[model samples]
Target: MIDAPRSRYQQVADLIREAIQRGDYAPGSALPSQPTLAGKYGINQTSIGKAIALLRREGLVRVIKGKGAYVREIPPISRYAVTRYAEAVRESGTARGAFDAEMAQRGHESRTELVQWGETVAPQVASDALDLTAGAKVAIRKRHMHADDVPVQIATSYVPWELAKGTAIAEQDTGSGGTYSRLAEAGHTVERFTETIRSRMPTPEEADFLRLDEDQPVYDVLHTAWTAEGRAVEICVHVMPTTQWVLHYEWPAS
Candidate 1:
């Protein structure tokens, strides 16, 4: 059976994408206006709009409010490796030390800003992950992670109030080694971590926060840190733009 012909906007979008890739439209350079493109292609202005919208959805372009759409400058790629969780790295007293190392390896800089800090009743999933009863209070440590000022990931950690009550984990800053290192000093050593991830379109607020295209997807990761005694010490949820990160895990062959 023959496949259906591509839609008008799809064809134009593909053409524009090829032009961008071929250096016809340089990165950070604005594309022609919708009316201009429509006239150039002898198509309806709506079709031009639709084509630009498609490009935005693919992250090939970004629309600047009050201005216009421009070809996007793709950022350099970086890896989120399983080895970032190594004890040696965490023990060095920078909870983010692992990420910083990875970024440096790629000639990028890593930074974090504390967004929300204090205590809250553990949300259901966090409650269960930490093995606490529903409604149990937990210290909440929220951060905005960035690569060269480009917002990349939002992380929220839920630690049982019992373990964090008098510790720095409940503060705006986790201090030297980051939360895990501080937890270790407080008798809640993290011996292992497990992460589960899923991808979905971001919520309205999340898209705005991450500065993502309305239709772009984000990866949601649930990370659980466990103690040697088999107790869950921290339950962290990471919201990362799918286009901004790559998760890599290395394991021995079975």
Candidate 2:
């Protein structure tokens, strides 16, 4: 096996990250000061800062102005399938889903909150995801998913508002119903969903909204659900910080 060289800062950050992962520093708890970390590691405070920066990029810790760094939400390992939640619910004839079941079995409870719903997709990012022509109308749905009160995923979805207007699908809140169920009730059966996955650092705004740590890296997942006619009805993008999340998918045999 080839030995990989690691930097002092990386080594220090890994130590701190491991501590955080082991719940030594619980979420919302403060970490030691830069000088303390430097003293403990026998490195310069600058090196400590670099290590903390690494943790921030990995979504492990958030720095406050006077309060120092704090541990934030960490993701649960999720065993997932491409199958829609609605299908799982229907298959089991239960309101809860197989995905939720899997997570609960692992000692994590899944919770979702619908943040916003609107009849327009004004943002360029949302418009593109919905595959709308320039200035085309689209519905906007924003939601957050959590595991044990720690936010794990932040999602926003777009649907052609012109097509969904006056339909019950566009009016429901996250707690009242799921978008998939609403779409089915409104007579658009989702036949398939195509997903694209990527990763990047969260924007400052995203960091604030998702309460992400500076050391945390987020996974960006984009999905589009289509009907049998091949008309795309829903497009969703989810940003999840790595510490608090693992996106598992089982690929069907080719």
- Best model number under TM-score: 1
Candidate 1, poorest ten consecutive residues by summed lDDT: 87-96
- lDDT for model 1 comes to 0.81
Report, for every candidate in turn, its global Cα lDDT versus the true structure. Answer: 0.81, 0.72
Q: Report residue 80 deviation for candidate 2 (angstroms).
A: 1.7
- Model 2 segments more than 4 A misplaced: 1-7, 21-23, 75-106, 109-111, 125-131, 173-177, 185-187, 213-217
TM-score, every prediction: 0.82, 0.76
Per-residue accuracy of model 2 over 1-254 as CA lDDT, tens digit each: 97789988899888998999899888778898889889988999999999988877665787878879888754446646464454456554322344366557678777867777777645776577666777887777777767777766777778788766776546654223456666777778889888888888888867776676454568888888889988788887878776666666766698
Q: Of the candidates shown, which would achieve the greatest lDDT relative to the real structure?
A: 1
* Residue-level error in angstroms, candidate 2, position 26: 3.8
| Cα RMSD, model 2 | 3.9
> Candidate 1, residues 125-191: lDDT per residue as tens digits?
7888999998899999777877766677788889999988988888876778777877888888888
RMSD of each: 3.1, 3.9
